[model samples]
Target: MTEVRVGDLAQGFLFRRQAVQLRTELSARGQELSTGRAADLTDRLSGDTARLAALDREVALAATLRRNQAQAANRSAAMQAALGRVQSATEPLATTLRSAAAGGLAGELAAAGSAARGAFEDTVGALNQSTAGRSLFAGAATTGPALAGADAMLDTLRAEIGAETEAAGVAQIVEDWFAPGGGFDSSGYLGADSPASPVPLGGGDQAALDIRADAPALRQVLAASALATLAADAALNLPEDTVRALFDTAAEGLGSAGPQLIGLRADLGAEEARIERAGARIEASAGGARRARASLIEVDGYEAATRMEALSQKLESLYAVTARLSRLTLLETIR
Candidate 1:
């Protein structure tokens, strides 16, 4: 059996080690109380780094998807408003043209011409509309206007139909210019060939972010408007029947385009709905992911505070014991 010594080298070494451990624990607990996160994640997590990394990735992906969904929803809504404007401008002109064709009254024809010019300008402006500095109808050409000016597009059509005497000839010329590889195609359209890419909603979902100004329904509206414009021109010197024929064709074309235009609007509305739903889901998932991440790394406040108090008392006791040991001498110890 051996007697234990109070002020030996072994006792001094044990006290110093205990003091160092207490100080480290106090520092860690203090950090946890202030920051609400584990001071030593590796030790707190039991070295399970892979799970922590996976959780971090989940939170990041959800955040990115939420941002993307918001952008897509805004773009889609803008497209809908732009299309509605175009429809509003073009729709009434059809009824006006039909009235002019039936009556052939000078007053009605004059009103028709003025209305045609206004609609042409408005349609061109609508096609060139932008949202947040991005072209709404330029397909993939997001930075620039989707079409040339109203005067330019009309002038090109007028040049193509130049001096054509008969309705058949004028109609053919209109076809050549408005059809693919024609005058309007060559010089009128200013947008890119490829449309803007779809935006991601979430979970591999995507939404069409734009509608090209050169879409078939829109092209039909422009072409029909051009025909009305030519008939209304005071310079062209078109015969009475020819003017009537042109207006009739324009009115008929617009009537057909109304449904197709509405269909395009419907498509955009559907996409808007999808984006809204995706946004809600992403928000929910993001909240869940964030909570999971906090659970993984955050420390309990009550536990940290209690542990700090205990460590403080232990440190004080170690300090007093060490001080007593340092003061003790060999003579006093032997006595």
Candidate 2:
């Protein structure tokens, strides 16, 4: 082979280029060692980024679903607690009405009526409860109270009953007002007619998150309590037997209302259970996505450390070569 010679400038350029390349490699290796992940995901993907992108998207979606599920679960729990308070308030009133129906004296009947009024107020307070500033029973109208204030609702009931002289008439008016799509829609409940959309938890699963003041069970309880309020007022004008009949009817209505409230509670409990299960599934799915993404981009610590050591050696060698080349000037070579 013929002897080949490199000029000083060419040698210097070559040394500089090698030094730059080595330094770049060292830097990349250092980053991988520090972060335990590849410096470049695109390079790791090796011209097939579609799978990595899909997994990353899945992870993002799963994170969003986790937040949604958490919010739904919290709201559902608040609703369940509110329902418990409502039930507790109504049960005592129910018991008192039962006593009144069992031929209680006027004073006892009046006392029961007072208890009913208190229960009605307590129930209203429960219905209007909020979680994180969002109304619990306002359906889609989450910013405002679900029901009108207790005084307003009771006044509306009284107006609806007007001068009805008998218990039957009072009961009919109460049903007309309190039943679905009735006067209560316009007067008592301030919540939206439509319920909120179901909460989406990943993997195509969703959980219901709907509660409203005018739900059938709630209406039943509210209507029964309103009738008790009316009976208390009518007690002064109506005959003792008529008043007794009124209390008897109110007692029976409250008895039926209890089961209705229980049914609503059961429904809410089921919803809570479903949300919890969905949350667990979402967490598992999110973890799988994270692991898949990590596999795509994360480097093996031991392998990266080994590569870093090798790069360090190469960089040291490159620096020495560059330094020796700098020292070997044309004059030195000529000497």
Best by TM-score: 2
Give the per-residue lDDT digits (tens) of candidate 2, residues 1-335.
53346776687788788878878887998899899899878888887999988998999999899999999999999999999999998887777887886889989878877888888898899999999899989889989999999888877777777777687877788778887788789878998988978888877788787878888888888888877877787533555565567777777777888888898889999999999999989999999999998989899989988988998898788788778866676678798
Worst 10 residues of 1 by lDDT: 1-10
lDDT of 2 at 56: 85
Error of 1 at 116 (Å): 1.9
RMSD of every prediction = 4.3, 3.9
TM-score (C-alpha, index-matched) for candidate 1:
0.84
Count of backbone clashes, every candidate in sequence: 0, 0
| Pairs of residues clashing in candidate 2 | none
The TM-score values for the models, in the order shown, are: 0.84, 0.87
Q: lDDT score of model 2?
A: 0.84
lDDT of each: 0.85, 0.84
After TM-score superposition, the amount by which residue 150's alpha carbon in candidate 1 deviates from its true location, in angstroms, is 1.6
Candidate 1 lDDT, tens digit per residue, 1-335?
A: 43456557687788888899999999999999999999999987899978889889988998899888988877888888888888999999999999998976877887787787888788889889887898989988899999999998777777777887576677677766777677776688898888898898778889886678878898888888888888878878788778878888888888998999999999899889999999999999989888988998999999999999999998998898889877777677899
Worst 10 contiguous positions by lDDT, candidate 2: 234-243
